[model samples]
Target: MIGSKRWCGVAVFLVLLMAGTHVGIGAESLFRHFVKAKGDCLVDGDQPLRFVSFNIPNLLLIEDDMEFVRTNPWRLPVEYEIEDALRAVVQAGGTVARTYTISVAREDDDPGTPKHVLAPGRFNEEAFRAMDLVLAVANRVGVRLLVPLVDNWKWMGGRPQYAAFRGKSPDDFWTDPQLREDFKKTIAFVLNRVNTVTGVRYRDDKAILAWELGNELQQCPREWAEEMASYIKQLDPNHLVAGGVQTHELHDWELESRVIDLVSTHHYEGDPMRMAANIRAAAERARGKKPYYIGEFGFVSAGGIRYVLDRVVRTPNIAGALIWSLRFHNRDGGFYWHSEPAGNRLYRAYHWPGFESGDAYAERAVLGFLRSAAFAIRGLAPPPVEKPDPPHLLPIPDVGHISWRGSVGAYAYVVERAESPQGPWQVVGRWVDDAAVSYASLFSDESAQIGRKYFYRVRALNEAGISAPSNIEGPVTVAELSFVDEFADLQRVFQMGGQVSLGALGARAFKEDLHRLEMSEGAWVRYWVPGEIREVEIRAFGQTDSLSLELAVSADGQEYGPVPVVQRGFRMNGRDYPYRVPVLVSGRIDRPGCHFLQLKAAGALQLGRVEIRYE
Candidate 1:
């Protein structure tokens, strides 16, 4: 296989390796390296590796004072809330989990220093003590903790005061024997920190994915990162050493220069596709020594997040990506980050699970599909471009969004929704576009009664037509309903059959009057006709104004009698069948008091229900 021999050489080498014949140094070394860096050949491990870089925002949500979470209703220690988010990732198609934090409340401009802070409780102990709880949760969930090499400190003394103490750059500190000794000791401590929750040791736990040296090394000097990388390799050689590279700092190669285990970076720019290309280019300079990971990529909302994921996952040589963070339910605010619907939304479109509150199930529709595919692709030949789950109806209350899955080529999709599992169903959304499955729409319910259940289903829509419904998905209850009725019925008037209805003598009528629908169902509606009339009447709100047929009749619904004023109209409002226009009559008629007048309807229709009252 060396020196571009031919396909035959690769076949021969594969056969020899299978036979345990011990091939030549050149072939053997290349084979082993490929096998190890890629994955075991026996299994289909060619799928790209998936690593999610999450800035857990752990400490931020902790007590605002950097105390226990209980004191801060808005904050929960990472241990209490991170599992669901990570589990969401696992369900979404992520393979590796990495987390970060601010440690303590400090100035945004403060010089980051690798020092301990004076805080009470276990974290106050330093290293293992400071992040014991975080490390514990990481172990419990079987993931890794990305400990920032700096602490949150005050910036009041200005950048110089703090930088001087913390080492103006990586060079200022690592080049000095005293500081280098301290840096090495810190690395040793970090590598040794164990997770007590799962009984899985730090270096031992397969869960501890990788160690990120610094969140974004460009915050310091590139030379400092070079020193830090060397220190890390010398300290711990087993796990992957990563620098949380930011997109803005892609040019910082100090960490990349050393024999680092993985090339990692973060992107905050809205474009993941462009960012992926940028990150891949930077990672390629590593000479294929290690794979690349997007540790801190995130979107401000669901759409952006999903789009970025699709772009990054499809890119060549990309290991995987992690959203910037997860946090308690809230409106959009805070640092340059993005979260799941279980987290926040920047604008209102359709309803999503994480919109107002968090819904773990909605998240699973996407996450679960991803995890399954990731598992399938590990070490196998890189799969044709894959997709997240298609938008299928779930027996859930609403559609958080819809997506498709497949290699980049022709694809079909279907959408379905229902009040229950075994009953009437409706198709709300569908597409045959070749775009990979991803977030599509927001599903919400306003009329759903609390505690009531609903169902949904999806099937592949192909060249012929719609396919059979996938499966009965259901049991989504209307958790809450905030009906404001701000617009009233002023918008489009909906009728059962898209037509007007008339039934029962004297009791009902159509084409009655002109009046706008208002917030109060009982508000009055008025109209006008040109001409005179001894009597006048109109129908509305499922009922007629009255049966007074005295001296009123007209060929034109707009005109009534000799008196031009008779051609005028009036109106009323009340609960009645919708889409049934009120009927009006005016002008002299031979009959009087309660006489019946018949008016023909143009369409046959049935109103869900009807209401009528005096006009």
Candidate 2:
């Protein structure tokens, strides 16, 4: 009888353990609160919730042939990738992530690739399972998600695919009754389906902070957005609903709608004051009826980011801001989106852990600002806001002197000097004044040797701490100009034609530490040559047999003629990773006094530093 009792006890214990595992008991223990919208702010239980989030469009979709996905099919190992991305967000002091499109199209038709939506009304169990892992991992990692249900663009098999599936135009999908019904069915199918990995229905899942109707639905009528938002709310009242509209599309009635929980807007403006003014106007229009979120905002300048973020945190009605994106180092051994569109070309990808090589924006300063703003929005102590704008270094001709713009609100400024653009910089001067709002900061390194290159950067300092180092300016050499474009700052100098972009250097070069100009076939870079020229040396990196390029010298920017080129290949440590084979192309400009020098890629190649040996 005692032996029988022991067997029964063991069975009971096993049953309980199985039940706990199914419900994600371990993950549930970590996050005990569910996020809810209360007035204009999101709250977790009794505590008001404020978050700085990032967008990761392809979090759930995995490349089927990846080694991790192939080996761990049962466990849905792609969650590990999601975990890496989420951990980066949390580490950068971000609390939420706004994913791109969660809805995959029925017509994707790629057999080898994983499809989220296999067919109309029929979902891919494997893709759904991947989503299940995303939520499960999100809960475990303590990051909230704002999931977009569909896409405004065709890249993800969005509305266009939906319309195509039904033999209708993309616009008809919004107004046609049958298409609307079909969309509702898809929504019902997703929300009601039981998560295979989590053992919980998505409607019941608390990990999702909100449901975005669709991404940037500017073409869709406002009424359709309202209808879709309402339909989602009817299906699942647990989560908030956001109309993912651009700033221009937002209306007062939309914010006041009973179904719409938040109003989201995107901004890609360069002007900080204009960006802030738009936000303030949106907040006023919201009128505390619904929270306003800057769903997407990115700039090619650190000052621009700081300006937007500073405004966002100070505004009481604004819920939070999520930057345009964050990219992870996936199992594929590189970051995603190699073929990004031209408009999004300038936005840099922030890597996990170190978050280095971010374009234009300073990673450390941006993260620091975000962390502080997150606290401030939550009614916690304010973060230090003393980081100053980067000083612009302008070299004076014929003198070994440089002048810089003074920083606002800086108690002092520290100037540092380095031999190369990538620095082991030593402090050259310090300008200090307790009463001064700004300093007339200038330095003359008369003791420096002539003909040697010198790099200079500056930082603002106060009692709280020092700001991020300013832009690295110089290689101020006394040598006669051959050609010099470090490709360090391309915002104002370089002009691109055809299909070329500024990208992080895959291979390291001399003066410019991080960036390179990537050129596809027929693409070119036009540089205005200030003087009469002779020979030009181009440093480029690409596949040995694959890369072909030509140098053209033109008196007018419009027309050009190719110069004779000599190509050589060598090995070097790549900036994107390490150990890359690159090619160096050299040529003579037989014609002098050319106004423009155009570097045209005969094939796909990356142009690093361009130096012209001129007369």
In terms of lDDT, the best-performing candidate is: 2
TM-score: model 1 vs. ground truth: 0.43
Q: Where does model 1 exceed 4 Å of error?
A: 1-48, 52-55, 59-78, 101-123, 126-148, 151-185, 194-204, 248-256, 283-287, 300-308, 328-353, 356-615
Per-candidate alpha-carbon RMSD to the true structure: 18.7, 15.9
Total clashing pairs for each candidate: 61, 5
lDDT tens per residue, model 2, 556-589: 7777888888877654323222333456677877
Candidate 2 collision pairs: 482-612, 483-612, 506-575, 507-574, 507-575
For model 2, what is the alpha-carbon lDDT of residue 263?
87
lDDT, model 2 = 0.62
Error of 1 at 464 (Å): 29
The candidate maximizing TM-score is: 2
Model 1 lDDT tens row, 95-186: 34555533332223223222232221113233344354544433333344444554312211112222344546434543565555555554
Return the TM-score for candidate 2, rounded to 2 decimals.
0.59
Error of 1 at 246 (Å): 3.0
* Segments of candidate 2 deviating more than 4 angstroms: 1-26, 62-77, 106-111, 332-344, 353-356, 381-615
